[model samples]
Target: MSQSHTSQFALLTQRRFAPFFWTQFLGAGNDNLFKFAFTVLVTYQVQVAWLPPAVAGLAIGALFILPFLLFSATSGQLADKYDKARLIRFVKSLEIAIMAVAGIGFVTQQVAVLLLCVFLMGLHSTLFGPVKYAYLPQHLSERELTGGNGMVEMGTFVAILLGNVAGGLLIAMPGVGAQYVAWACFGLAVLGRVTAQRVPVSPATDPALQINWNPLSETLRNLRLARESVAVFRSILGISWMWFFGAVFLSQFPSFAKEVLHGNEQVASLLLVVFSVGIGIGSLLCETLSRRHVEIGLVPVGALGMSVFAIDLYFASRGLPQPAVSYTLGSFVAQPGHVRVLLDLLLLSLSAGLYSVPMYALIQMRAQASHRARIIAANNILNALFMIASAVLAGALLQAGFSVPQVFLVTGLLNALVGFYIFMLVPEYLLRFVALLVSRCIYRFKVHGDEHIPSHGAAVIAANHVSFVDAILLMAASPRPIVFIMDHRIFKIPVLGWLFKLARAIPIAPQKEDPATYERAFQEAQRVLREGDLLGIFPEGAITRDGTLQEFKGGLMKILQAQPAPVVPVALQNLWGSYFSRVEQGTAMVRPFRRGVFSRVGVVAGPAMPAETVSLDGLRERVGRLLAA
Candidate 1:
């Protein structure tokens, strides 16, 4: 598993990239660890205070979240308007200031000041979110985005769990004290700042970007851009939903550990440790499961696990005795009966991890390049919205007299139902679901030399577009997902558009009617390859009306000039005979012999050719020959 994770880690260890990954990781770690420390101190250690533990818990959570609502707008704009590396350095420096205050508060036992620091850190993180997400497309390719985000998420949760354990252990230390724990956080903050200095310069995407001073209006503008594509918007919703689940589950750990498992806060921290580790594990698994692309086929699968296990957790805890809570980890192990709680914890975190990583990748892959940062800002806004709602929902449920187990049961069942309903309505998840399913369960894919397609970054796939199903078929056929240059009309289809937008397929039109479309398509094609995807284009401009291939258009020439990614010409022979076969077949059933279920979906790839060989007529002639052969 470590070896499998090496490529993902390369993004971190490599000098050009590692600093940003660590900067973001350390910042998140510091944020959660401090919040955990404050929450633990108020809820357990002090036991004397001005307010009840529940009120303090809610206030602490609120303080961290309020910053996202108030400061994300400014931070997101700053990220777009300046060099991200510098902005990150500035943020880390701010952390040093916040941590210094936190250390003073911890030693003085000033809970209000600690909560204030939590709010400040939340504000710091809000500013970092856009920078964190937007920085990647500048450095990594489309292929690397999914894997990269997986590593980020995995690292984050692992850090979170470690910080939780560290906070509890440090405060309870016999010789050491809470002040020392705060100093250790401050030390890590300094380490993060040093790493930030090493991050490569990512120049401003919009140096002239106007700062929207009003958080509400700016947040609204950002969401409007995100909603331009239903698929992109849906991805945002999916991500926000995970945060919703996370906030609820994370907030309930204390009650869950006490009344249900009959274990103390230490066991509570252990449950969190198990869950966070599971999240990191599942996140890393997405790279292998998705084959290193932003394949969101796993989102619904994650949702399934969330709902299934939640229900089972409810059942698992039904009859068990409510043993007295114990602070020592050994007590739960001694009882040997609360193992089910442990399983539920691990499964819930694993599901949450799987749900999140792909959604992050999808937003990056699909958003307009000029406004990608803003789209991520919109995502943060929705995430904030979801998290707030989760808190409200949990409070309402509990106020209505639902037990912790019952709430778990309900949320879990709702997760499954919601997931199934969404997949059924969209069908893209199910389509990719089927594509991946048939891919793994039925036919094994055999790619001879994927290296022929650019290994480190992006490449162009110039194929004779033969049918309406050509792009999706090629998507299913290739080992790597391809960003196709498709017609504007096809992108409007119901189910197909859902996935195309998700795949970030560029749309083109005639230069006369829509110069904007033509210019945008060429620009987007270049961006797609530059972003590290295989840019597939149909030089024919349209599917063949006659059986013979048409003349290759100048679009290919234009794309070659824009970026000059190596071109791999592809040919499709017998694909027109099946249901999708444009060769005018009987329904899907009538087309087959050797071509039964899939028929022979023949696709041939020629050796890499020079961009100099990329002439309109010459490339057309070669593709025509390959089609005939």
Candidate 2:
């Protein structure tokens, strides 16, 4: 997390967060432990008459996911309609019982019994998914949300890594065999439930809301509730697609190491370890890179890396010799071309962590608080659907003669297309990417009183317009998206204009210059504020001809009359002398040739004023005070 924000590690010490965190971590660890143990049993130890090991693996995947499909809707409603802490405790208890059943299956070596345990484990997870995520927003502050999610994500993948290692080692032990794996599962389950008992109470969001026991109708309703917001719904799609992309990479690892890298179980475990570690590191980095804000800018960065690394992994594996038998871990690493594959896996997984944490935080922050659990339930359903699709698609492709590396190639290319579509559909992700890039590279920007900005809801921002880059500067500093109101002429510029359009900036023309454009801009501004979006306007209405405060105009008065949102007064300092500003006293549009590349700039945000108290003179005074500081 940022220096300004509370440490994510500190969260582990808090009563409100620690118990729930451990409960979820232990539960996730238990899931992977049992799952991988089953895989080991099928692959090496046990013989099944009905199906081949490969087919059994596919069936297990389907069986595990099926419960999510069947039970997620009911679980979502339960989270919303009952006490979340109690629901979590109940789910944890169910996990203990399910693991007991799994232990018996392992002791007796009954494949059917083990498979049923997988389905029951899935059912247990489906019930907890909604409650686990929704509980965060209720307990943590908005500024803590990103850091909190980072810790949770980091803990989860680390647990997964440990579980995979433990499961493989336990199942392969000489004397104990599957018995140790079974006992470990039972113990972890019990520990998770015990930890969950200490979680602070989380009251029901909608206690009186009718329970929908029917999975079919409740699932439909859940999806509909998720669809209520375009941003929230699209974020869900981004998350679901990430799972699809990740499942492809992960599910292929065992075969990829054996067939492509010609390595044994150790090498296979190495790949999983690298991937999980990459995700854990990347997840923890999200808080720092985002300055402890739920910055979606990292999403595109992650998507771009996912494709690049996947493509590179394909090329790295090209022309590899096929050894008759798998190599030892040392022999595998000593191979000439293997390290590239490892590096690609690390980078790919890191990007994945960067990609997912923010989307999860966004859903938690943006979704209606009342239905947040159900929204997460909707996300779980979609994730399961995508994972199932990945399995089917990969199976079809492999059956159709696509090699593992080729599948990586195809998925990487598909990521580019899907990522582009998502970014276009929700340009906020793209805009934030640009904002972050510009802030780091183009300017040494600093912000003061940024906490005055609200994390949610409608507000009006009145900033002194100094440069053409003013909106970009403000947008870079702002945690949330701001719909900037720009002069119509500036809006018609080439490359920057396209970026502004993507950001959904409103272009205003002076009434005397263009009446229709002026009317439309104000109308659009009103609509934007009414929808609870941030609307930014330059009180001066245009860039200053001189490096001085221009008179605050009456257009703000018109906007306030139409839609009264809380007015946040802001000022941009030292940008008047920047390259983009009109400080050079020349006819040229830009003077980058005359100015230094990285100039120091600051944005100061004044305390928000009530709608009724905002006026032209008052705003001018407030912005003037901030500018002077």
Candidate 3:
């Protein structure tokens, strides 16, 4: 729980996480597998009196989504009110019973009964949704939150890929047919129940709270809880938007492959497989990319990449040879510029992982534990709504005579707008833009002792400011967001000043120069710490003219004594010669481009010490040792 394990995969070998993870994985797979098999049956084989196949597809989609709208509020409350492990077992048991009924429907081939199965499966998923996500924060350490969520998401997409493949293959089998699909669902349900049984005890978050059985009122209550925190609410919106975007892209894959790429079924399958693989790989890399922290900085970067690749995909698909013969998967890849199109799809999916994992982690980390499940349920409701809107919009556009590629072009452009609006709404997303730009593009950055940075709670980062960009490097490398306390002159500088404002950096002046400004800066810094946000300051007061550590100022001690927060010692290494630094030893005039591109730099964090024990000498010594290390 301390995040002692460095690798996310290491969690798979731990008892606390392993069973719950597999239970969810198998359960997700079964849901998709059964749904795909049934949909295919409804589309091609069944001769139903109720509706046509196209209409049936819409009906089934509506039926599945209806349960989330109706039942999610109740399920979210139940998760908070009961032992989660036991609740999971109950859900799996229900799954088995539903599968048993589904088996009967399969044999009878009753369209109404199969539709009932679809609705039942949706109900099961709705109940499980909150429990699955809310369970992780209870088990994983905060440092593990991002990695853990990433693993779950990667596993989920992998399950989806396998489930879709297995569904089609099993349903089309000669003798087994629907029976094989039914048996598989039942077996998976049983296995899920077995795994659920092995899950560690997860006590109710709020057992004493009374249940609200009224769906409509309870649903509104959950939505209110989700909106309680603007950050969490915005994060939920980001997630819902992702679902909308994904739904639009995936809903068109079949038609996109056949009509646009002029490819057969195998080619469609190939596109899906590539997309899934890319997402899975990207999800796994999130932990490393984020430096084992819940780095939402990747979210804006992901949104940017997603839109860019989607637009490129439109270009990659344009003016292609329309052959008389349908292309096989191999032939599709072999076509001129087709591989580029595949790359776009893969990158688009990869960026989807980047966009989503952090947002999920952010919600989990920030939401109140007592109402976390209900908040997730609220998110589910919105996701369903957005997805439904996507379907309707896509249908309307296609009806209005837009090509699939053209629709993608429109979707991509709309994504850019949506992503920009969200970033404007939440400055955290914009801050991530700064972190990503500096860390990924400007510098080859590395961090050591990142685990020493506390995952939560108030702390002051006392670092030696070796250069103007020292704060930038520290901001990028720190596990948590840091509010740098800097000189007002530095805070007033051009483009850098704008970034400082976005980062919420507190600006100070010397008491003699401006007492009001100095006092205000201290008040702001204390406020940040009291609010449990990280406060970063250069105890050296300004960037060093020489690379050697300067005598620490007394202001840091005064601030720490007043606030009583933990002090984390940070040292920026190998940045003295950068353009932002006074590298010539005594000159104010600075070169604009001396460090060149992709300069190697490092940040090292020492263990956090009590604020009571913080001193100018002690912090300077600690940071000096770290810099020398």
Candidate 4:
């Protein structure tokens, strides 16, 4: 709720965020602690005919996810209908009760009861999932969404790592291991409840909504609600795909360490440590890379890196030297090829963190506010299904005599294909990717007065266009999407034209030259404004043939007369001589590398002028001042 913090770490000091952060951190840690300790207990100490050591982990995982399939739809509705803080406190209280029962099971070594506790804990997480995601949007501003999600994601992985370590150590005690595990789980549950109490009240988004008790119908309805926004629905699928990709690596780590790397259990733990740390680092970096906005450009970048590193991991481990004996953590690190293996895993997981955090932030930012929680619930259900499918696919691969490395290879290739498919379906991701590349690599692009761009509602951006890539750079500068009105001639260029088409940029010609195109462009611009979307226009009407300001045209004035909206004046500076600009004999792209790589360029926006008072000369003067500045 606090907007004063600039860095994500500053969030840890605030009451609004700190309490929720710790509550969820402790809950995640406890979940892993209880499950891992129980897993070790069954695999090493207790024996049951129904649950064999080889399948104990699988059985626990299945039971845990089963609740999500059955209850996520109901939990989503409850989250929407009740205050999230109240729901959080209630969930924490339920955790305490579940742990109390788990304590008894741990002490008595009742495998069935402990297994039942796993299902209960899964239920606990299911109830909390929708609330956890929906609560962030309620409290944090759009600028804070990415940072908040990053902190929560980083904290979660760290907690899971610590929980697994503590659980293994406590449950391996020479005597009374089970009792120690029981006490630890109970204490964590209590701590979580205490933290939950301090969380600031978060009001329900849809308090008056009636409850839908039936899971099957409600699940379908929730998904339909999510699909109302194509971008949001696809983002949910992207997040689910990330879970599927991650589930493969996580589930294979132990076996990969033992069979591929010839390492002991401690080595497997070391791999977990490396992967978790990588994810935490990457999660925290999102806020910095995105410049405090929800930037989805990083999604494609993340996907590319995930595939690259996963494929490299396969090659890195394909022909590893078989150890004469099992390797301990120390000796494993001492090996020649082991570093590459660990590095591959680390980078792969880091890419995963980058891939997922933006999708989560995007979903929060774009989903309909009233149905946000249900949408998140739909996401949970899909994530559960994907993880389950990952397990089945991985199991089948292994059964078909594929090595772990070969499985990684297949998954890596599959990731590339899936990413391509998703990007084609949602060109926004690819569009952002191009914007990110052009801004960060082709030029050292910077923005000033970016806050002047309205975060919501329809607004028009009036700027002096300098280069063919001006729209792309502007796309990088603004956090939200902008529909641009461009000269139709620019649409004839090969790659740039395709990109503009993908961005849905409306192209126009002079009324005398093409009356229909000119009229249609204005109609589309008005429709965009009516839909509360940002419309961008080059008020100069065309790129300046010389590296100087051109007189502002009346097209922007025409649009404003038709659809009243505030106009933000923007100037693109130091871009006239760049490769994309018309600097070489008054023709753009005639000569390459005119300014070399990383050419200094800037986009400056001034405060919005009310639509009623805006004029062509006044707007031109405003842009001129910004260009000089």
Candidate 5:
């Protein structure tokens, strides 16, 4: 309810978020702790005929993710049909039971029982995954969604890192390592259950919905529901691709540190620490970079960084001299070349954090509340599939005699291709990227009273246009998409025109000049408002030839009469003499660097006026006041 909280860390102090954060944090820590300890036990100390040491880690991982592929659909349905808080408590209770059995397996050294417990733990996670994502939207405002998700993501990775460290340390003790690990797992599970009991009540999104028990049918249905929103579905695919890209690096860390970097187990652990810390830092940075909104522009930036660093890592890993002795963590860090390798790994993961958090937040913001959990379930299914494919592909590459660094190169190149394909499919990402560049780089853009723009429903933004890039700047300031009504002539310009077309800006001409185009533009604008989307119009009819206010036109009045939506007055400041404006002899963009780069410019929005009360003069007066402010 405290949407005004500016810092993401503030959520950690609140009842609405704190208990749930700890509950999930402990669950993730416990999951990693038990699994890693069991892995070490089997791979190092105890050996089994059925599960060879070479394949023990792989087999355990496969079993753990198997439930996501099998039961995610049902779990999503349950999350939608029941109170998430109660479901979380129930899942934590199940963790306690599973950990109890795992304790017995550890004490008795029963490999089969431990493996069975692994599958059950996987089931527990599958059930909790939907509840975890669905609960946030219910409790947090849209302003807090990105920050909330970032905290959770950062916490999840940190917990995993700490859990793995604890597991590895506890499992290496003299004779009681397994017993210690058992007790630690049981304690963490109990703590998780206790925390879950304190989580605030989160009611079901679709309490009246019928339950779907069949996984295959329910999965197909969930996918269909996700496909209802192209943005949300593509976001799911984007997130899955990220997992695929990451799994390649994560699954190869041991081999990479040993074979490529010629380092010992400590060096591998050091790589994990760097990666986990980098991702945590990037996740926490999203709230600040996005200004507490779901800004998908960062996705392209992240994708680009991911590929660049991944490719660099390939080159960094090559041509190292073989050392007589395996390098320890300290010795590895002492080498300058190894530092580049670590830096590449760190930056790649940081980019991944940026890439993923927004898509998750976008899915939460855009998906229908009724089936949001089901869509997240679909995402989980896809993520599982992609990770599996990543493993298979990496195996195939290595089997064909590709070195670890070569595998990294191939994955990075694939990431670039995949990123290009996704961005082309969704031009909104590209539009936002351009908008971000224009606002952050071309000018030192600032926004005021942006919160006055409605977060949802239909509205019209009536602003006094000053430059060709006003729409792009407005796009950067807004949290939602706006369909701008622009001059038809402007659509003939080169790069900006293509971007405007991609943004689906409705091109209008004067009624006397082109009556049909004018009518069609107005019709499209009306339809956009009727469909509860934002519509942006210049309202002054054309950009001013001189650096002064132009008389407002009646187009806004016509739009209000037809759609009856509130109109928000906006003003563009300090851009009249800029490069894109008609500054020199009524010609625009003829002079380069007219205002120089990063020149001061601003967009200020006034409070919305009721549709019935709005008039041409009143709106113009409001925008004039905003411009002068």
Candidate 6:
């Protein structure tokens, strides 16, 4: 499927891709919806029973996470051993059964039984986790991976918000009780099944391999596979850290709202809203920020802002006398000095958006083709472990009589520490920094109309590809990192693959080589524009062997017409014959670089042009002149 064929939701109405999106969307929705209802029920309606308030809180938290630790390993293996589409349908069917069981617990008002269901739901999610991440690479093109991940992330967040809002409102409604929640779950499950039916069948990548029934062994196996590539492992670490960071903050929010801001649920929720919207904005900006390929440069930018706001929040809460605990949104809004609290929430979330989107894209790009889902499962297992640890660490602070504000300060400090720890271990961030350092330290490089690249929206970037190092150079040189549309074959090239993986290039090929891809790529490009990203494409389709630009292809015309974003014409010169570029035509062609030395490189951005002017000949002529200059 080409971009034009699957550009729209209607045109993309295919079986392989659509079902997984719906399955994940509905799953996210149900997960949050139920959690919201459960939290409200446990906190407000249920009487104190087998445990103390704090104990119950801890137990509930344990219940929510236990499934991931126990089942994720098995789940990851399952994805590798079976057809993903059929597996998804099976999972949806299981959801229907789980809903029925949940209905009984809700109606009976049995806390233990309800707790069982929470664990069960988590178990369901655990099983689906690996399948969820792995299934996409099978379905979408490399060009579409980041955009598709962005859509899935965006959709998941929106669905989560709606689910949480609905759960809270529904649990309090007359006549519905928990039964209504169960019914909602059932309805969504049915819808998911319908979508799954439309999903194209994805065959098992390794069905012939013997199934590993042992969770511990299988879990280790998956991690070993992921670690085969250093960048892949680092990407998994980045993802795991997100779960850790998320668990730390989200766990503390209620306490922070109650003790620090002295505001009600509404105000606290307002904090959540700002963060969610921020992330949504960031995820959408990936296409624009990344320039339509795998641009992880924003990760550093996101991390920087996250730390700054965390520090600002430390000051924001100072000098304000704590108000009596209130759960009303209005009461908190009326309080003096609560504005900083909201801003803190927004900043944390906005920066989080910058941090996470690229991590997901990186993982998707780097994981091995055959075991992507299992690798994702390994990631989930680590995420569960880190989140559980995050909860315990956060809980220890709360138990030690530390106020929520104090906890925020400590976690903020820890976030900065952990982020630095990971960056030190991986050095992609450091590598990017070094790349920029060398650029600034050694070469006087300049990029024009990068603002034309769109600061907050999506745009098309047509560049002339002359070397294999184009992605690394573009990512390093551009004011905002751009995502490059690339050749699928490049994804398998060793260390280059890691570099490509870190940058998040979307690898593509002609339909003759890969018939069922790039449809999603176009859809993802549209998604980036919607989210405000600068999508970079090589209209010539691949690097020019002759060191000359080739004619543009058909997809750009369709993409530009559909998206209608500004087009940036990028040119590269003197990158040829460098260490990362093509020097010879043999297997031992690549040579190592000198330590701390720099390659002479040049990148220039021409003025922004309309999509109409970004046609095959026009873009080529403009970039040709720029490259020549």
TM-score of each: 0.77, 0.96, 0.95, 0.98, 0.98, 0.71
Q: Against the unseen true structure, what C-alpha lDDT does each candidate score?
A: 0.76, 0.89, 0.88, 0.93, 0.92, 0.72
lDDT score, residue 181, model 2?
93
lDDT of 4 by residue, 180-255 (tens): 9999999999999999999999988899999999999999999999998888999999999999999999999999
* Most accurate candidate by lDDT: 4
Please tell me which model should have the higher TM-score, number 2 or number 3: 2
Runs in model 4 deviating more than 4 A are 1-5
Please provide, for model 2 over 497-541, each residue's C-alpha lDDT reduced to its tens digit, 9 standing for 90 to 100: 998998889888878889999999999999999999999999998
For model 1 the TM-score comes to 0.77
lDDT of 5 by residue, 428-452 (tens): 9989889888888888878888888
Off by over 4 Å in 6: 1-16, 51-53, 321-328, 334-336, 433-629
lDDT of 1 by residue, 112-200 (tens): 78878988888888888998999987887766777888888888888887777777677776545678778978988898999899999
Over the stretch 307-335, how does candidate 3's per-residue lDDT look in tens digits?
99999999999988998899987788788
- Identify the runs in model 5 with alpha carbons over 4 angstroms from their true place: 1-5
Q: Model 2, stretches more than 4 Å misplaced?
A: 1-3, 321-325, 586-589, 593-595
The alpha-carbon deviation from the true structure for residue 399 of candidate 5, after best TM-score superposition, in angstroms, is: 0.9
Assess candidate 6 and give its lDDT.
0.72
Pairs of residues clashing in candidate 2: none
